[model samples]
Target: MHHISNPSILYFGTPVVLVGTTNSDQTYNLAPISSAFWLGYRCMIGIAAHSKTTENILRSGECVLNLPSVDQVEAVDRLALLTGTSPVPAGKLAKGYSYEADKFKKAGVTPLESNLVKAPRVLECPVHLEARFVSIHPLGAETGIDQIRSVALELKVVRVHLAGSILSDANPDHVDPNKWKPLIMSFQHFYGLGSQLQPAKLASVPERLYRTFDTESAKATH
Candidate 1:
């Protein structure tokens, strides 16, 4: 049975990413967003036109996508209603948004230097991707709303930084599913991965790697 109810937001569920962009003052601005997706080496992020992140990315042409673990949800949430824009827009103001020039300080996250981009990566995040802005496309206006518009930014990944704890010893390029847990946003709420139900039949993980993981699990249990 399906219920057809119009929901105010369509964020069903998505991995939360902290977008790092350089401000006009050459300072880094960190913003939390979930409307991002990746395909191949290119990633697309949807951001409001009035956001400082969008403006910075357009001018600087580079940014970092920092993937925080479930444990960092509180830090991410602290940045939810804070905007880097000095003059907070009326729409955002009405929604309880405030201006925070120093987002890194407010969120209590350390900024780490990146090799290929000007934007710094969040030191607390497990994964960091240095990317160069490719293009920005204006999205169609919302239903019956001519004043509101959004833009989708396409970025090409230039470098990827992964925490050693999340990397597989068997395959340096593969992230261990057992160790990597991403923070997910579901309809404005935060959630983490539940217990694994079963192994995928067509999993890319090699049999030997699975055996090693299973052996480690058994050893820990004993």
Candidate 2:
């Protein structure tokens, strides 16, 4: 049966990404965001207009997108109500968010240096993409937003890091889907990817064919 319905949010599902950025004080800030998508080697994430992570990215132009597996959901939850913004933003404060100076330590994740960016990567996460900021597009500019609340930030992945456990034995460059269980968020709740049900016809195409110039460019990056 079909029926008319409207939900406050349309977040059907998306992978949770721990965005790592360098704060003004040279400290590291990590934010878990689920409004992210990728095409080729470029990824875009939606974040609050005044978030600490956004401020850091705009200033430093570098960040690390860390993908956590299902097992790390506890750590992700610990950061749910913690904001790096000092004094805590008004909206966030109304929602019980408190200022957290050391998100990396609070999340219990170890940091590692990146080759192409100063933003450190989360050692516990299985995947890390050292990225550079490309641009930003404001969201909800009209409809009396009062103020721009969010923006979609584009990023170019300059380097890729992966855990060997998720790589295919047949080809190190390919990720074994069966082995990578990404943490997902749907309607503000955390979940894990389920086992594949059936083979996709799209599997007929080779993943390598979709590789972009950015992938090759990353090889020569420092």
Candidate 3:
């Protein structure tokens, strides 16, 4: 028998992504999100109302999804907690702190140049996705004014970066799913991936090569 959990709000293993956007003033806004995914090479992101991310995409039509790891999990959590519109001069997010134009500095994340997008990639993260906003859907929330139904970002995979330790040239199949540990939210709680049980044809990395990777993707759809 299975017990029914509350549906009021549910948080599951959603990968934490640093959404890189540029404001109307040409200023950069980085919003940390876990509501992002990929279809083959296409990427999609979910954003709330009147957010800098939404505005930036509306104006510039481009963005970057910077993947994070367990070591940066605290920083990722911080970005989710602190509201970007808050009146505080500079505040704390979670593991990372906030600043007017120095989020990268506060979070201790490195920024690398991108070939197709204006926003830079997070050097620390194992994967980076450059995307273009293709469609938007508005969702009605029971409590909030209105939530983002879902935004589909169609992206042409321009580049993919991986850590040296995770990349195995000798064994092209050396790519392991567990290597890129992402933070996923479920029922308002955060959970780390468990492990990679099976290796797919795309890569033949052993299941035990990475600890955190296996922990998270142990039973995930991706």
Candidate 4:
């Protein structure tokens, strides 16, 4: 067997996020990106300069992050192909396929008015985050690409909206782990998800727990 290693590669394994923003003219824009995560209660996003999404965000300072489930994967992938900066095909503005206008309809995604932000949320996404722009940082392009400079944003989470199906009326705060399905992206590939492992418990008998923990074979077997 042969192995090779590289350090200067972009190998971040993260979930795909669709950022919804409104243009200066008050038109909606959907940007498919993979550079966002939650830090405590704060949601931070890393965008790139020269992107339509970044431009609209800089102007409006408000946006919504929509987390789509696996069922909406195909539609969300289409949005990634169409750019708001590009010209729309012939004349489909009324039907909602315009380049500068909202593409939610074209992508078969539904929108609902946000509580605090002007940007709307994707009704199909299981998780929705209402965010306020806190800060933006500019970093130069990675490989001399004029349109690929990096922009980091710090956002405050105003509210979190989760699907009712994920919560149990019996224990609301404790979401059904099985129901919290996330789409994982790896090396430009999308996968549904894996099983959820149960957390270590304190109620187990000490001898049994010790044997499980002490044996090296237990780790290898799993």
Q: Judged by TM-score, which candidate is best?
A: 2
- Candidate 1 lDDT at 76 equals 98
Q: Show where candidate 1 strays beyond 4 Å.
A: 141-148, 204-222
Give each model a TM-score.
0.87, 0.96, 0.70, 0.75
Tens digit of lDDT per residue, candidate 3, span 11-58? Answer: 556777787776666656677877767754456676664555676777
- Clash statistics: count for each candidate: 0, 0, 23, 0
- Residue 216 lDDT (model 3): 37
1-222 per-residue lDDT for model 1 (tens digits): 999899888998899999999998898899999999987567899889779999999899999999999989989999999999978899899999999999999999999998878998999999998888999877875554566568889998777789998999988667888899999999999999887789788786564554333233322121
- Give candidate 1's whole-model lDDT: 0.88
* Model 2 C-alpha lDDT per residue in residues 148-196, reported as the tens digit of each score: 9999999999989999999999888889999999999999999987789
Report model 4's TM-score to 2 decimal places: 0.75
Alpha-carbon lDDT, every model: 0.88, 0.93, 0.63, 0.72
Runs off by more than 4 Å, candidate 2: 144-146, 220-222
The candidate that wins on lDDT is: 2
Minimum summed lDDT over a 10-residue window in model 2 is located at 213-222
Global Cα RMSD, each model: 7.7, 1.4, 8.5, 10.9
Model 4 C-alpha lDDT versus the unseen true structure: 0.72
